[model samples]
Target chain A: DVKVTQSSRYLVKRTGEKVFLECVQDMDHENMFWYRQDPGLGLRLIYFSYDVKMKEKGDIPEGYSVSREKKERFSLILESASTNQTSMYLCASTQIGTGRTEAFFGQGTRLTVV
Target chain B: AQRVTQPEKLLSVFKGAPVELKCNYSYSGSPELFWYVQYSRQRLQLLLRHISRESIKGFTADLNKGETSFHLKKPFAQEEDSAMYYCAHHPTQGGSEKLVFGKGTKLTVNP
Candidate 1:
């Protein structure tokens, strides 16, 4: 079965500390995305990559960055964690040439920045 | 800019009752809409897409371009239907690969 795996299901980080959330997809999809889910704001896109070594900022890319060195891996980096950054982070993957736009999501990582 | 709005934060219904989850979007170009569901402890997954025009688990959604809405409807609500439903869209432009999601609506079907 196809899967998107996130390294951590739950994480806690201190304020001002750097953090990394790793995601790997076995589907070999060309598109990978990172989104943050909040109570009232829904899922907001943070960043996405359509190709290896290429990335683009999404609607909310303020305090986050992403790295995609390989096709199957996409890493979200929080340079300096803040209390407001505590939210559920999700990773998704989709194929480019499939003529479909459905995204398969990971189990999500619930991050708490203290 | 493209945007999706799900006004109701929560919708509650009893078993066997008909349920409709409202979703509205704003995008000038052609739009592809989708409904996603996330049950407790499960990852979010695609429930249905407008283009497919097919029903899954007895749920259906119709894209009303005239009203700029895509509402998910089910004839009978089951207790197992309790979950979070998200309305998403992908515009013809840069949004084709990335889905823009709205604030999800939590559905509760009491048995």
Candidate 2:
């Protein structure tokens, strides 16, 4: 069984605070992604890293950033959190491939901003 | 642009009743489609895909290129089927690993 571990299950942060959510996949997948899931908006991508030190911005990447120092670890950083930025954060990983491949996901981190 | 669409936000049906969850897509190029389910208190997982033409847990989905749709179906619904179902797309950009997901449809199966 593949394991994608998230650093936190639930987190509380104040407005304008800095927050960091971590994800580590045991499979050493080359592709890692960060997504923010909201009720009606679905899962919007924040950022993704296909290789160490490489990052690409997603549709909703204005308030977020990501770090990939190693193959298995990907970190999502909120430079300055806001109430609107609070959401259920999901991390996923997949082996780099040209053909169809399934992504494995972590349990998710539900962040609350007050 | 590549996109996935799940028109219904919720669907309710009785156990043993036939169930269908609709999914549509708009992609300029040939794309792959996927149906993902997230059961209550459980992580989201892949339920089926159009490419493999396989049924999972009695559920199956078909890709209609002319209509640009991939709809999920089950001959009989079950209470354990209640969950958030997300339709996803992998654009013909081919190597794009980031999948564009739909808003999701919440299925509730009654006893």
Candidate 3:
């Protein structure tokens, strides 16, 4: 089974603290994405990486950053956490292809900024 | 800007009744659409894709470029079908391979 594993299922952090949400994919997928899901805003993309060391900003990447030092690992980083940054974060990975392919998502990390 | 819209935030229906969750997109170029479902205590998974043209779990979605929509439909709804459904669109020309998802619709199939 293709598995996407998240480091933490739940996390709580204080304001102005640095945070990192780790994600790992067993499958050798070239495309990995990080999204923050909110009640009314849905899953808004924060960042996506097509290959190792290559990252692209998404619609809502203002308060977030990503690191893909290795192929199997993708990490989302918050330089300074705030109360507004509290949300459910999802990580997904997919192969690069022309045909329609579905992404495999992790269990998700629900972060709470205090 | 490419955007996928699910107008209904919630939809409720009785079991064995027909169900349709609407999805519309606003992309200038061709789009690859998909339907993802998140069941209770489960992660989101792909239910169906437009290019496949195949039905999964008795659900099918037909992409209409003219109407700019790809609505998911099932003839008979089951209680198991109750879940959160999201409509997503991917730009064909973009190499990012990122999907833009809608706000999602919570489907409730009452017994």
Native contacts conserved, per model: 0.60, 0.42, 0.54
Off by over 4 Å in 2: B92-95
**If scored against the real structure, what TM-score would every candidate get?**
0.95, 0.96, 0.96
lDDT string, candidate 3, B2-110, tens digits: 6899999999999999999999999866688999999988999999999899999999999999999999999999999999999988657755577789999999999
Best DockQ goes to which candidate? 3
For candidate 1, the per-residue lDDT at B44 reads 98
Once all C-alphas are superposed, what RMSD does model 1 give against the true structure? 1.5
DockQ ranking, best first? 3, 1, 2
Candidate 2: tens digits of C-alpha lDDT, residues A2-106: 489999999999999989999999987899989988998888999998899988899899988899999999999999999998799999887776236777889
lDDT of 1 by residue, B1-111 (tens): 668999999999999999999999997656778899999999999999999999999999998889999999999999999999999886555434666899999999998
Complex DockQ, candidate 3? 0.65
Clashing pairs in 3: none
Error (Å) of candidate 1 at residue B65 is 1.0
Off by over 4 Å in 3: none
Model 2 Cα shift for residue A30 (angstroms): 0.9
What TM-score would you give candidate 2 relative to the actual structure? 0.96
C-alpha positional error of residue A13 in candidate 3 after TM-score superposition, expressed in Å: 1.1
What's candidate 1's DockQ score?
0.62
lDDT of 2 by residue, B54-109 (tens): 99999999888899989999999999999999998754464666768899999999
